[model samples]
Target: MSLNRRVFLGTTAAASAAMAAPMVMADGHGKPRVVVIGGGAGGATAARYIAKDSKGEIDVTLIEPTRTYYTCFFSNLYLGGFKDMNDLGHSYGGLAASGVNVVHDWAVGVDRDAKTVSLAGGGSLGYDKLILSPGIDFVDGSVAGWDITSQNAMPHAYKAGSQTELLKAQLKAMPEGGTFAMVAPPNPYRCPPGPYERVSMVAHYLKNNNPTAKIIVADPKPKFSKMALFQEGWGDHYDGMIDWIGEEFGGGSVSVDPGAMTLTIDGEETAVDVCNVIPAMKAGHIAEIAGVTDGNWAPVNAVDMSSKADADIYVLGDASQQGDMPKSGFSANSQAKVCANAVRGALTGSKVFPAKFSNTCWSLIDTNDGVKVGATYEATDEKIAKVDGFISQTGETAEVRKATYEESEGWYAGITSDMFGAKT
Candidate 1:
């Protein structure tokens, strides 16, 4: 199904009275309250959609710690110097104007039995329905010799804000022939193609500026998303500059010394000027606190994204293990729409259509050189099963690559608008 603003609005209107299920009233409360945690693609989009479509019938509140949200998508472009920091930043004012009560604060805890979310600021918010989209948090001790305290020395720019700026600064300060190293995360991490794209972008910067700088990637996984295409681009654009050590070469056995600025792979130590360590990830702590996560991620029903542990609670984005869909911003945004529809229907007796989802991930290798992989999905009793998919080929024409890059730029604009509204 094609998902767009017009289609969404039209479908919601037409389906409003089609459901025979009883409306879940707010139990003497004036309005059915929806509390959404995390204000990235998933939470923000879900809040905006619920508020926009509910038309004052439901109350929507979005909780986010940062007033200026930086998108993880396209952040590698910022490292490649294709975009500035401001380019990735967005304000929550637009979401507020769209009728979402945008709360700027951290969500400290969830009281599942009480149906309340406690804030770090010493208050709690009750909700008829709760949506958790807190993104990913690094798993402790996933990478030896590195932890949150060592972040300054070995920056994990995966969160895409201060860390991104820090990494860029370190890259710029590197000496002419200095070494830059990355310890790539294992599979089932956010943005499957993200780490490789970062390697490409970092190499892009080094090739233009440092010229003789080297990049070493120690990957636990044997292969990565768009591996063939990334390898071809590395040969064409950054030959001899990137050394990727996969598991076959003992890349999985890796450690780093932030204090000494040293990287060890397979018992071979190498002094590196900068190290980027992306550790294993899990659903944000709130998901675990809410008692919805079986392991690292929260498992949800494919049809409505409701947590398996609680019918009134939903999970979205990287935090959700809904099956088939990769943890990406595009996937989260798509899931948010499906979820908003279901939540609205459950709360106000609105029509809820069958859930359909789609996601496309775009990566840039060099200047105006882009590639993508995407799939369509349908909800099944078991999971969100993939239906059809497409990917950019290894040897595409320059025109095609350039067009792909332009298409990504457009998508960035469109998705940001979709999540944050008309940029107030």
Candidate 2:
């Protein structure tokens, strides 16, 4: 996806909806109130899809702070200087247009016993079935000296929007020959391949604008998503511009001094001119407070994303533990469709047709040169498992690379269109 903001909101009608106040859905006759928390990739998609599929039987209420959402999927383009931040921001106007109630508020906590969600404001909202897709929250104590304030010193840029902009600005402001350090998180984090893809993008920028600059990855894991292909691409393409520190090479773990722009790994400290720290993550704050997360992520039944702890609640996105599925934007979008059908089934009190899902995540090695991984999945009684999956092979000819590039664009158009295309 391009980093041009225009793509997020395709029409002027969406912009006008952003200017309006919050829309509330009344539980007419006290129908099932499905309160969805967080309005990003998963929650927003679920709310819109469930509301449309249920045909007014389910009272859909979405709790989120922002009217506009910037996607993490394409924010790397912005960081790599290929696109602007505007290209990745999405608006909630489509949900409103589809008859889904979107409230601009932060969900502080969920009162599970009382069945109410406490908001930052003085109000409390109730729900019959709560769909929690609040995404990932940084795990404390994973990186020493890196708390909220320290975040500004070394932006993670994992969540996108302002943080992504900050990372880009810092990169632009760095000296021509400066080093860029990316501390990649351990496995089971949002966008498994994202950190590596990010370094590729950063290398692309440095190669063109600051050839003397270097991109270093401090990785916790020895292997990563499409590791072979990424490594080959980096070595053959960016080559010397990109350097990686695997688990055995003083790269796996991290300790950071944000003020110093320094990262310590394997008992040795390494200084960098710029840093992007992606810490460990769990379910978002709201999900944690609601007693949904077992440790870091919410445990859900694979068949429908229904929380194992709560009957009516369903978890999706990076927050939910879907066995064998990597947490990516495409995964969240696909999970939403599955959750939507489950919500409809529960509301109607009948068995629904089986659901199968597919996800494709495309990362740009450079502009016009992209790599992709895709999987088609089915749900068993216990967990979601991949039935088929493939990654783009390394050193494919230009023609094949071009075809995947176009395919990537086509997938983005189709997924976003199908996701946001639904009427409120």
Candidate 3:
């Protein structure tokens, strides 16, 4: 039987009004629901892509407590005043406008059997599939006498925003010829090249303001990402100001006294004006609570980033122990897209493409001095394996370095747009 209804015979304007969907499925069936935890590089991109690509066929809810998401990538530049805090801040308004349910609340727990997410704001959300990209949390006791309580005195500033500002203030207050100390994290940490770039930025700042001040780095790793490039830059630009002590020289065994403002490295005590301690990190707390993590990090199937423990949940970014990818924002965003495509295909019967991921980490040595390393990856049965890669050479012309910096700036804009769906 066919039913015909009279339509508007006269045309007034070509327009359509947006309609709201229920918090849960209301079509008398279990409509697919995707709950994304975290809203930075990984989570935001996953949510937006799932919602947009599904054409609102799937219910997407993004759980992030903060009203604005601050990026950690260019945070080093902020320390040098090359960019300000505002430049690192981004809003989720655009993602909301794209039909994603943006919830500014923490996901306290995930009941995998019940398929419900417990929220910190006194509510619960049900999901057919869950995406967890909760980023990183520091490991206590990794740095002796340094914990959340002492963050103010010896700021990590790894998460960006206020901590970055705090570290900058402490740097400004350093006395003439005073020392600034850094205890770099071990391997399998977020942003492999981040600490080195930060050192460069600090060197740039100190050279301009307090040229007499000195920097001491106690690194657990023997060699770091972009080592040759950074070493070359330090020797060329900040000669005689920066000293790096690697693991062979007792950099790995370090302890700090926040109260005394003293750092003990290789059994030698050195009083310092400021200390930045980046402790060992693991997946965020929620992953452990959800029982999806294997101790420190969540292991996932490389094919689609599905949890090895639960097929209904997927983990992305720094929280996931994915192979051949550093825990950087670029890596997270790349992984999110592949996961989003897989999740969308599973729920909506869409065609899932072959998973291919790539990442590039760029470091600013100085204003126009920049270097980068990146690789393309393919998901094998075992893990995501790197196919090929490239890195900046020890000596590059000023033109090439400037070009690399500009490329990084463009990438920052592009990635933020990719995550937040903003025209910015």
TM-score of each: 0.94, 0.93, 0.94
| Pairs that clash in candidate 3 | none
The clash number for model 2 is 9
| 365-391 per-residue lDDT for model 2 (tens digits) | 876788888889999888888999988
Root-mean-square deviation of Cα positions for candidate 2 versus the true structure, in angstroms: 3.5
Best by lDDT: 1
Query: What lDDT score belongs to each candidate, Candidate 1 first?
Result: 0.91, 0.80, 0.88
| RMSD list, candidates in order | 5.4, 3.5, 7.8
Name the regions of candidate 2 deviating beyond 4 angstroms: 1-28, 349-351, 422-424
- The order by descending lDDT is 1, 3, 2
- List, residue by residue over 305-417, the lDDT tens digit for candidate 3: 99999999999999998788999998999999999999999999999999999898999999899899999999999888999999988779999899898888878877877
Better of 1 and 2 by lDDT: 1
Report the poorest 10 consecutive residues by lDDT, candidate 3. Answer: 1-10
Q: Highest TM-score among the candidates is held by which one?
A: 1
